[model samples]
Target: MRHPTPDPPAPGQESVWDYPRPPRVEASDESVEVWVGGVRVASSTRTLRVLETSHPPTYYLPVDDVVPGALRPVDGATWCEFKGEAAYFDLVGGGTSAPRAAWSYPRPSRGFERLVGHVAVMPGAVDRCTVDGEVVVPQAGGFYGGWVTSRVVGPFKGEPGTWGW
Candidate 1:
């Protein structure tokens, strides 16, 4: 069964990027961008992820953030105990060597219902992540979250369950 957006760790929620993440909610009408291979792929003001590990919030850029035209559907899909089924994408129009460099869930489980339609591209797959034309420096593991250059909390996971992201 799904739980309510795990209330952010409370005011004293200790870690990094100190702040109550409120609750993983729906992406607003606004949109964020994800650029891989130095090319903008998609943009969507969608739901992002907030963890206690050691980094900043992971913004799940909506499929709208992606150029759509630049992505080619791939046969890669993964399931998460918390999130849901993820669909993969191939960076088709950019100089990136990755045929399938990003993934998302159009329909996510209730636990991760907020992530539906948002896309998170592998940071290692991109040169840099820029929000509103400003490049965002990653925290530790290079997982892009559109978080502007600043004090990051910790390292996010690259592959699922690898680092317990």
Candidate 2:
């Protein structure tokens, strides 16, 4: 299924339609925080976000900014045509765990080399994920890792009928 044309962007907002097809990665200085099981497992001022057409941005936190021992590698891998292979991780902190709640592309594709070793979490798998102090909503599908912030306007991809969009 496919979604209709994207909505227009209001002032101070960005339309997902303007994002790239192959995707682009940009460094972000905004504060991105992840809390799981009642504990802050990751907080970073330096992060990377991938912008792709029809999808909300996917923020990638450097491993250094994440709590030590907070991520445990899990068994399983997925491939992204644009980002290369991704490995999954469990968010293990505060005596709680969310399996395959995070992922990283150890050896990202050429254009996405900066993502190597940087982890992007599934917002739905954590208690909450915040960007610039605003709590984020997870992109609708369980498979995509995009984090939905108010700054982005979408009829975003990841919904039931948007898989082919």
Candidate 3:
């Protein structure tokens, strides 16, 4: 699957888009703070950024830290050639014992191997999760954004396929 890149915001504007093709998903090995069930989940690792949006920015997290019994798989899904098929999950608990939240590719396309088995949750859904020790808010609904306290550009809003690709 190949998705074309939309034009970058004109020197000073911003655009959000998620298309297929050069799957650009990255992850970190470092442990990040993930608060679910209002308690911090230890060993939760990673920060991922997806390069496109119509809704909000998507953040990725490691499954280790998220409470094991928190997520309940749902039938929801969205598609993009870049990362591949995104299966959604409904948050079971609002971050306490088990916090179920939004997540993506366990089987991302070849280009998006970085996101394999990585889960991205809604910041709005959790009590707190910090990037570099700073708290963050989920950028988009049903998507994920890894503590986007400081970002250089914006095409913000994790809505897929927004900009003209």
Query: Number of backbone collisions per candidate, in order?
Result: 14, 0, 26
Clashing pairs in 2: none
lDDT of 1 by residue, 5-25 (tens): 222344433334343333344
Worst 10 residues of 3 by lDDT: 12-21
Candidate 3 stretches greater than 4 Å from native: 1-23, 29-31, 41-43, 46-48, 51-57, 93-100, 140-147, 151-165
TM-score of 1: 0.61
Residue 35 displacement in candidate 1 (angstroms)? 2.8
| lDDT per model vs. reference | 0.54, 0.93, 0.57
> Which candidate would rank higher by lDDT, 1 or 3?
3
lDDT of 2 by residue, 14-115 (tens): 999899999999999999999988999999999999999989999999999999999999999999999999999999878999899999999988989999
Task: Pick out the ten consecutive residues of candidate 2 with the lowest summed lDDT.
Answer: 1-10
Give me the displacement of residue 158 in model 1, in angstroms. 7.0
TM-score of each: 0.61, 0.97, 0.61
